[model samples]
Target: MTEPAGETPIFERIGGAATVDRLVDRFYDRMDSLPEASGIRAMHAPDLGPVREVLKRYLGEWLGGPPLYSAERGHPRLRQRHLHIPIGAAERDAWLLCMQGALEETVADPQLRAGIYDAMARLADWMRNIPEDGRDQAAP
Candidate 1:
């Protein structure tokens, strides 16, 4: 939260929106190619354009940059937004794996990376929506 004087925000340390976009792009690209991500990848729309943009904005706001996502989408009810998806343990782990790989590739600051990873883990857990049957039939 509070950085020493002259220190940058974590958002800036991670290279801000452009860097975040590249990270998200690489993340989706990995999801498309990795066999481990096949199940979760199938849940995404074929076109990743919109998803990429949404993620960029969301990360920008989340990382202490401009409130781009909230400005456009209002409060980010992340749980509500993801409730329709079947995010069981497997799906959650796969998603975190992709994001971790991408963050390692993009963010150089160790502290920033750890902070982001911790937050992502919490958010991913909060997004879980799968029933005991592991089926995703809830409406978004």
Candidate 2:
């Protein structure tokens, strides 16, 4: 997508790699502490170090920074990669909750933060593999 000024990327607007790091760290911190995030947290390994790095790389590239994540691991195929996990409406909401908090804590610009959150919410929603209640969800 095109960014403002057609020059600065979202990555640079948000403070580049440093901000990405803080965002991911704060995200995990929230997932680890927020009671609402317990379900999603249970999906992760006891040691979050590896996943932390993976997310950092993923976000870095996603935000228009570097291509580290793609260079190491081809196309993200996010949904396919997470097909094994059972994410429903509640789980998606929980993940968004942690991400929202992290974005609020790390991003200074309100509009920029909201934009990022909107995109993330869409991605998180797409990762849901299980259906909630009476809704029918297509498998990945």
Which structure among the candidates has the greatest TM-score? 2
Q: List the residue pairs that clash in candidate 1.
A: none
Query: Candidate 1's residue-wise lDDT over 1-140, tens digit each?
Result: 34467777677877888898888998999899889999999999999899989988988878778889999999998888877777888998999999999999898888788888888998887677775565543443
Runs of candidate 2 exceeding 4 Å displacement: 1-5, 133-140
TM-score, cand. 2: 0.92
CA lDDT for candidate 1: 0.84
Q: In candidate 1, residue 3 scores what lDDT?
A: 49
Global CA lDDT of candidate 2, please?
Answer: 0.91
Please state the error at residue 124 of candidate 1 in Å.
0.7
Each candidate's number of clashing pairs is 0, 0
lDDT string for model 2 (1-140, tens) is 23656678999999999999999999999999999999999999999999999999999999999899999999999888988888889999999999999999999999999999998988888777787755646533
